[model samples]
Target chain A: MRRRSVVVVGAGPAGLAAADTALAAGADVTLVDSAERPGGQYHRMLPDAYGARAPEAVQHGYRSFERRVRRVLDHPRCSWWAGAEVWALERRDPGGAAPAAPAPSCPPPKVHVLAPAPGGGPRRRHVLEPDALVLATGAHDRVLPFPGWDLPGVCTAGAAQALAKGERVVVGDRVVVAGTGPFLLPVAVSLLEAGSTVVEVVEAGARARVARGWLGRPWELGAQAGKAGELLALTGVLARHRVPYRFGRAVVAARGDGRVEEVVTAAVRADWSVVPGTERAAAVDVVCVGHGFTPRLELPVAAGCALRPGPRGTSEVYVDVDDDQATSSPGVYACGEITGVAGAPAARTEGALAGWLAAGGAPRAGAVRALRRRRDQGRAFARRLAHAHPVGAAWPGWLRPDTVVCRCEETDYATVCAAAQDPTATEARAAKLATRAGLGPCQGRVCGPTIAELRHRHGTGQPPAGPTDPGSHHRPLAQPIRLGELARPPAPPAPDRPDLAHLPPEESGS
Target chain B: MSPRLVPARDDSVRRTDHPLTVTVDGEPVPGIAGQTLAGVLLAAGRTAWRTAGSGAPRGVFCGIGVCFDCLVTVNGERDVRACTRRAHDGDAVTTQSRRSGDPGDARAGERP
Candidate 1:
């Protein structure tokens, strides 16, 4: 009998748990991550990543995740791939585009992986045929524009956390962790434990208000508050470790000689503009700022899975997966942050449920479905957290004229702003001409929303949301593929001007 | 329990003695020795990295290299994520600007 295989993307908590479930159920499992290590960013393990006195919460989280990862790795039926990025997916079809398989039915899917081996020479591609596919692809931080934000020392709350947690190095003796949502809390706690004197936590939302709302939603309040309490207790750090918590305040400007030394912050009004007299300046060595996170949806988007507006402004795949963690796309399932940023426990539950359902085993009648409902409930809470902490419109106040917007292309706000102000340009052409925002390797996946928001403010008017039809934006090769791989044999010769010609050369050939 | 993840209790992590001069928004500044461009800028107390609307300040948030928040221009390259790239002696780092119109078309032919 042919061995059944399941591929789980992302080695974070959810993916690992799913792989474990599959392995226990006697299914062959493969777990993959872009990093050299498992645990994703949240459970990142550093080689001397953090100090010996690192917060117990972080230590505990990683300890638990590590044990689970090890358990999965030790399983005879389970295989693991670190530093492997899944670049594309191929199904046997004419368009080569994998049709969105209908929900809950596990299809034998093929995943294309790019691994630039440890020595770092050329990256190689490998394909895996899995009877079931699970996306635990996790998320990236939300980008907010602020003046001097283009300068050095300015980073995301997640980045700061990583340095403190994984590298065990503090950004500076004096640091500020500023952003919205629960994401910033761990960062603050980590920095404090790392011996960095947290100058302040410049939060855009009023914590009091969020706390009030969170309390009303007892479940959410408990989940987040518990996490926060754990981190604070483990770090043995106090609120003073974080400078006074300035709620509803946004960083307006961060200026220094060549680095960040001082930051200007202000309270944001309803119109998303800074309120006068609320502006204040704080002297600091590093400023870590972010709004929130957008789900990493490249695979799903490329898979042609229909998307609905996520809790945040991002898009998420629509699935009928009846609590069993299945996607409307048959044979494919999603859990964890990919299902929306519902945190770790929910992701683990969803993954286990999916594994159980995928393995010839039904979810003990209503039990499996009930677990799925619990996952959904957790997701709903996550959505609210995302909503409340959504990168508020007022974050733009932090951008300076010289601040960089697009790092991949080196495009900045001034150039992008000029293009948005161009009265005659169409939205499509304007984005291309100005700022070089969408022109980067990412193709504007990270900066698209921010660009659109900037354009609207600059009178570009609102461009319609939803996938751009008739536009060559969407095509088969979504992730970065090797140039040589694309030009391989049997892949057609050059078509000078094709509908999907706009795709990057690396992505186009595939 | 991985040894690589433990931080040395000593704060005396000696940085290489290499100085670089970079400008942030026309202000000539000195970068610290043996630090990433992002670190030098942060040590110097500059926080904003890029702006999206009305030229605001944005900075590094996810330092582990996942979030693309800490992006900036190093020399002539656009989108040179500040957090990952190391700063060198005499390196010129500048804050990015929000471009208008076709963002890529302006520098389309330029080498990355």
Candidate 2:
């Protein structure tokens, strides 16, 4: 029998684990990632050109991660497509020129890829139709809007860390790292390692609330000993560096002439509403703010996967998946942060399970059971995380009327408020059209969740489409493709993969 | 903000000293081979390369490819993400802006 072909989009921990297990299960796998290296942002690898003697210095669990990378990438059945971006996924209609007899319950979507050509040449597009697809597209930093956030020297904490870890470059001489969650500790450490003087680390969640969230389930914390130890080490480094960690505080505004010269931090209540007369300004060259993470949902949503509200009361949404990590759309599986904001361990377990099942591994396998239990623990951790570091419903109160809400369009808070108040702009789409908030080049990746929550809280515009609707995340084109590239025909499939030849002639570009 | 490269001794991770240069806005900015355009620009004490529609200066907001805030024109290709695009020697990069009269301006650059 021909091997079950699996195409895993995203070479992060989840995607890499998926590819590794699928190949181990005797399936042909194609692993693709937009980055030049296999590690997604989690293990963001320094460029091979860097030729670092001690590459593990900036990374965690490097030895294990390196072993996994070699196991998957060196496997003969696995094809690694580095620096390749999946521009779109076209759902294959069952009736349209598909193979007859034993039709797949869920035919995998046709993957449209703009494969990077060697030596910086123009990219050549290739189309693939795999038997199964796994999306581990992961997430990005979701920064809530604030006054002067549009300033040049302000950036998300992830951005600061990426530069520090990937490029060994500091964002500025003096920096303030402010956000919610334990992720802030690592970001601060990365900046410090890269030679930045971190003046302070501000967390929005009050210490009492965060303690309650974590301490409520004491026994469950044992499962996350590794994560806790990591955080403890990070805090130790911060202490050594003499960086102040402040709780119940957030950067409410940034101010500067041309770039950020100072950040205004304010104490906040449990719900993140700023306390009056608690504002304090600190002189700093850069301010890094990240409320939490927003999942990269374009691919999953495009694949027609159903979404559910993340955690409980938060406005975040995640791909809905079953015990086997199978999404609503058959032949499609989702893992990693796209499913929920569980860290790398959970993502890896979920990916392993999804990969095994997608490769036609038996459901009752011993390994499958272990993966399920671990994934469940990860979900519990995710719930505790959400409870501890919830994005305050009152964060919108931090926004001034003139604050730029959409960085791309320069749509301000006042404009969005007016649009919500206008009866003519009833639906979310209408408000978007009127205010031009999420219609910019980013297509609302950065500001979609913020806008949705804002409208929902205002209680004036059209109610959210559904309980799980994360408005404005849906975009036909997942990544930017030049018109010239779109107009051109795709290159013929590579001869090594017989599966591509099975695609209909029209789709194979034969 | 003076963004500088971490000295090799101080940096936790050691890096190869491969040198490269990219001309940004008619000025040659020196950088390492593996460094991105944004890395080079930030190291050169330059921020706010692009401008918003209101002519507000902008640079490196997300430092990832998602935000598109670090966009710059590379070798006549428009809207290349400076944060993600590796800086190559001799690459001519012109900062982009949404302000009127900028080269990216549709009406200003359109050919009849």
Candidate 3:
């Protein structure tokens, strides 16, 4: 095996495993994370808490992941940088694309990172130079607006779970977890396990089946069904506690004063539209809602990597290495939710394949045929989970005109639509007069789709949809650098461009 | 219960109590104090915002300002991100299909 140095950003599932695989394959590895330890958002750890609080299936997976994280941390050849946040990344040669072949052994691509000490004082900046880069910056929950969505008690399901898991704090005793997709079940179970009263799981998907849902021809369906049964059994604890699980329903409004006091539930149609007569109101203290997750591609996009739309509504990076996992960006590889939300077990297998490929250990030539079959079987199985529940078109019915849609600026649907149409011509000259979207702190992550959908209703073309151009980000400061930070200089402007500089290094040699 | 879509003119703010008026898509409509343009329009029963290129029904999704689904030209400015801005009296609103070019049209906070 050949030896090389690689940098893996994010200490999550893919990041830690990639480093371990690279090190085992004889490459020196540097692992960096914005947190004090590994275990990204999904396997969040409590500050004063101990062990995993999830059910047996998740705990078993967590143990394996934790074991790997520990092993990688202990590796002699591995360098770990905790509490490091990467602000940007620019090519050494600047512009264009990642190199097709390895460069002459001079200095590898440098990674600039910002690390704030644990006790909390001044933040320190550090750089890591490596031959290859692996980005696994995980994902965040997708929040849709509702009447009381902005209320103090209303947070994304992920945020609520994080608070409960990481801080040993619960949002409220009575919580209604609403929305669609497999994530809801796990989040609901987690909340229930934490002793919260889960009044109802308002899923947009119906309980009735369209057809006899088959596992598939090859027959791993039995195992998946078993897993689903186990999760159902755990969630059943809600019933024993007399908690209600309302299928084919969604939360239309969450009404309260400073916090959530009541939630209105509506029966949904096939397209996930709210039925006229099925609206029902129930009192509740806390409401956790999320549609799904958009795979985070900020780091990858910042690096100028190409992305394509995934089966899920979000965009994902395009990888050339078949099912084994390798990205089109040379030497760079990724897996897990970073590529797509394929769950833990699928991620484990994909990560293993990526590690093997990254180390120059190609599988047997003929094995491709069999590998393809296995991958197909697994992907087919994964699809069942993917389509189990989806945030439907009717989700917007919950939003009252005054409900704040964009959290950054507190813009609501009324203001946004007014600006889009320019009724009085006051906002007539706003940028991109046509679509009238893409305005806000997040650019358009929260409201772009809604804008496009509305446009469609008005007989306008679809909103120009695609991943936001990540490469357009140009910032002088990497992090929230204070005035004092600028005063100190680690070194007087070296000839080389700083790590993550959008410009190519000034000093380059053939 | 389905989420309640509050009427623009609530019982507390009936026309007899305090009648208000606002312009939507160039037409004058009855409005109420403290009501948003969206609430006013929904109460008036106008479904379309900006026409999709193919002309489809697009409305609010992710009600929070994040979705950007309710964008329109409230005044002369072309690309006003609707979700973030508030509607004022006499404000002009027009349907938008797509950005028409000038990166810096107006709406300083609006991103191209």
Candidate 4:
């Protein structure tokens, strides 16, 4: 019997684990990512081409993370296509089957990749048809737009950390790292090490809330107990650097003439609503803000997977998965953050399950049982974290009519509100069309969540900001390759695969 | 102008390469390899790239390719994302005006 072929999108912990486990189980695996490097956002390191001399000592966090990724990249049965952008997903259905599928029913979907350069050369697109598809596409920062967020000196905390790690650079001199979650700690430490005068780390979530939730849940943390060690170390680093750490406070607004010069830090209640009496101005050149993460579900949603309402209170979109990590779509599996934003350990376990299933393996029952228990614990902890730092919808209070919400099209709060309140506009997509909020170069990456929430508030009277479908509605060219790349002459169909009817047309020769 | 903030360059890690000059909004800016065009601009303390309808300037919001707030015209190619596009020596970078139309019909001119 021929070995099953698996295409894993993303090189983060989940995707890496999926590829490696599936390959180890005797399946051919191809790992794909947008960055030049393999590790997803969490374990991201500088590419080898950068030629870092002392690799381990340079980056913060565990080097073991990279070692885990190395296991995947080193596997003989796995091949990695770096710097590739997945623009579309084409499913070939069996004849007279689902109306969407153009061709006869083919079990797996064809992954379309735009390679800026395949072999240190010209850009080209390649098609990969797999026996099974594993989407480990990770998460990106959930931007809650505040006044002056679009200013030059302001960026997301994740972006700040990535810049320091990838380019060894910090944004500005006096930096204020503010947001919810402990993710800010390492980013602050790294910036401090990079000679930035960290004014303070502002956390919106009250410290009492975290202790109340996590103090008793010690057993669930398990192997991640080292998180406490890292936390203690980060606290020491901040204190030694003379950086003040403030809790129950958030950077409500950033101000500057041309770039960020100061941020208005205000104390907040448990739900993160700002307290009126505590507003104070702090002079800082760079304001790094992050609320939390939202999963990158474009590929999964594009593959026609079903989304169930995420954890009880959170407004997150979760790809419904069973014990085996299989999605509603046949032969399609999702793992890691795409399943839900659990930490790396949970992601790895989910990936293992997905890989095992995709590789056509009947895993040992005991091992499967153990993986499910770990996933449950990780998910539970994630829910508690989400509950603590939930995105307070009251942020619209910070916006004036002119404050820009959609940076791509320059749509402001007033415009989006007008569209949302328009009696004709019932759904979020209508607001999107009227205001052109999500229709720019970004296709709504900046304004999608905020717009959807505002629409939900005005149109439906729904509250929380957690569970909105931030994914772009089924557009074929989601990534937006240049038209010049697509206008090439149609290539001849391969003799072995002459029926290329299911795929979109592209020029065979330039 | 005030003196620029000094970065922590003394760490164990070495930069990918040396700095070279790239023109940002017609001014010569020093940029290094492995840094994006936006990184170079942000390093120089210039953030607002283009003035939009509201008259407030837009800079890097998402910092990744998605946001496109860090967009600038590089060598006459409009709608280029400065966050993902690396800076090269003598690369001419200019502010992207939101109202300006793209110079092409770029899809024309066939053979690569």
Relative to the unseen true structure, what is the Cα RMSD of model 1? 8.6
Which sections of candidate 3 miss by over 4 Å? A48-60, A93-109, A117-120, A209-230, A312-324, A363-378, A421-510, B1-112
Q: Give the range of the ten consecutive residues with the poorest summed lDDT in model 2 chain A.
A: A95-104
Using all chains and alpha carbons, the TM-scores for the candidates as numbered come to: 0.75, 0.95, 0.68, 0.88
Give the per-residue lDDT of model 3 (tens digit) for A1-510.
Answer: 336667778776667767777777667677787766677776654322123233233232656676787789888777777766776565554334545443323232356666654465555545555667777766656666677665545667875565444333345667788876556766677666555678887766776521122223426553345445555675576677676766787877878754567888888886677889888887776788877665556566545445654456332232223455655555566666666664555554455555555655556545444444544544555556555554565556656667665543456666655554554332222422433334333555554444444433332232433343332122223333444543444221111223223333323221
On lDDT, the candidate that comes out on top is: 2
Better of 1 and 3 by TM-score: 1
Give the per-residue lDDT of model 4 (tens digit) for A20-132. 77887889778888877777777667545356666565454447666766777777666777777888887655542244434323476678877654334445666777889
lDDT of candidate 1 over A220-311, digit per residue (tens):
54335554355446334545553476678778788887667798888885435788898888888778886777566667555444445565
**Once superposed on the true structure, which residue ranges of model 2 sit more than 4 Å away at CA?**
A94-104, A459-461, A495-510, B106-112
Looking at candidate 2, what is the lDDT of residue A243?
96
Model 2 C-alpha lDDT per residue in residues B11-98, reported as the tens digit of each score: 6677776888889878888998888899989988887898888889999988879999888899999989998988888999998878
- Scored by TM-score, the top model is 2
Docking class of 3: incorrect
| Lowest summed lDDT window (length 10), candidate 1 chain A | A491-500
Chain A TM-score of model 1 comes to 0.83
Which stretches in model 4 have alpha-carbon errors above 4 Å?
Answer: A47-49, A60-62, A94-106, A119-122, A365-368, A460-475, A489-509, B1-9, B14-16, B25-27, B53-55, B100-112
